[model samples]
Target: MTSAALPPSASVTVRVPAKINLELLVGPPGADGYHPLATVFHAVNLFDEVTVTAAEEWGLSVSGPQSLGVPVDGTNLAAKAAQALAERAGVDEPVHIAIRKDIPVAGGMAGGSADAAATLVACDHLWGLGTTKQELEEIAGGLGSDVAFLLSGGTAMGSGRGEILAPVLARGTYHWVLALSEGGLSTPAVYAECDRLRGSVAVPDPVPTPEMMQALRSGDARALGAALQNDLQAAALSLMPALTDVIDAGLEFGAVGGIVSGSGPTVAFLCEDTESALDLAVALTASGAVQDVRRATGPAHGAHVIGGPRPG
Candidate 1:
């Protein structure tokens, strides 16, 4: 099937989920200046859509709710995936990709990495390259620290600049209310902010908490909520003090706990149920701590192609 009929030059759309770091720990900055981290990443329902179509020359056209900020001219992660894959597969035909950004950019949700992961999977099928999941994950890891989570699409412990993965069992979907920020925040900047807030130097924690790992396995919402701590939260809060209100309002409205998503300034709240998530979202919106609110569930699947969609 790899060579037969050229697969009809079809269009494929993959839905990619944004990720949340249930527990994010930042250690000393490496020689590369990127800190070592131990984090538990969960794929959430909030997603960005990526569509790929065959074209004469490799190119990317970005559009969607937040497309205006997305770079398209070969700088996009999706474009990079296409170039890498095409070179590896030895195909000359360029692939055209359209990205619909639903997940907020720079929201600490792995939006760009997710797009790259989606493109790798969709194009594998669209171009009939026949790449395995393991092979694709190898490519995904090179794209970003969180890219592998997009491929695994579940709970996993990430270490080593956040690329190494070991899956964890997280039972039941965790409801969440996400407060969207007005604009994006840089990941490196957030880390730098953490360093600034901490001052000159820092020390690594003893190790990943046994309690945090156990809570995930137990799958209790309250337990998980209590365990939701990001070492970067202090830095994020220090950098953007306004996030304090966002975090406060979420909890005031009955959210179990709240923290800055990924870096900042998107805030995520853990709720008891779907109804509670909605109520928290409404209350938080009324509080005006953020631009908008979105309710979602944790541990959702990664990017996969949709049956119908075309880019003309």
Candidate 2:
């Protein structure tokens, strides 16, 4: 087996994007399934930059607006990726990671997953492991359901507990306006809320059919906008009742449709274009229901190689 060796003072920088679920359908309860889901994810330009470097020992240092609750030790997914790679490659070298967070943590933006993907990519290059993108994605998938998407980046369909992926043809930039929340809503908690809401309604439905995927490919803004749906919205609204007004406010300001980004709290508002997105951002920032607002675009590429050496 190969081993990872990190030279002291080695460092690399990586930029990773947040994700938006374009469409999500909830399925019936399984033995373990809160509900099987069908989701189309779009990686946005909004990102958290991570700098990894070699140190005397393994450690993590996170800085930025959204670092709270993020683990700096082995518990962090970035650290976990480093350890996993070390074991897999049979390398013993310490790594030091510094995450400069731009993506909102726990805001349903896949900030942690992005960091993990960046770590895997940066560490591989830093150690001269020459691990392929596919190999990195496989390891990332092991890290979490959303981890692979972080590696893949861009527009893609997620199914089978959101691990399986089919890259979609979302060309041209799709603009977005994100409403930041005060804190995060737990994924498990959101799923549980869906289950609880499901108990009150009829049995959950099956995942969306291929037609929905075709709709995204058609790229008609209205068609895509009309087709956008989320199984988790009920749970998200249940957890944060105020989200209802947030959605309404976004629509009132001329957004096509607004939905919770992933689990809860953060809401992604689909806009007509980049100009409209900026306008919405300005307006939504003043809206009382949110913390901050950001403009983003989709059909964007997933994680990519940067010119720098890997961080430790």
Candidate 1 backbone collisions, by pair: none
Off by over 4 Å in 1: 1-9, 308-312
Q: For residues 114-198, what per-residue lDDT tens digits would candidate 2 score against the true structure?
A: 9998888877877788887777777887888888888878888888767778877665567788998887899889988888887
Best by TM-score: 1
lDDT for each candidate structure:
0.82, 0.80
Q: Kindly provide the TM-score of model 1 when superposed on the true structure, using C-alpha atoms.
A: 0.94
Give per-model TM-scores. Answer: 0.94, 0.93
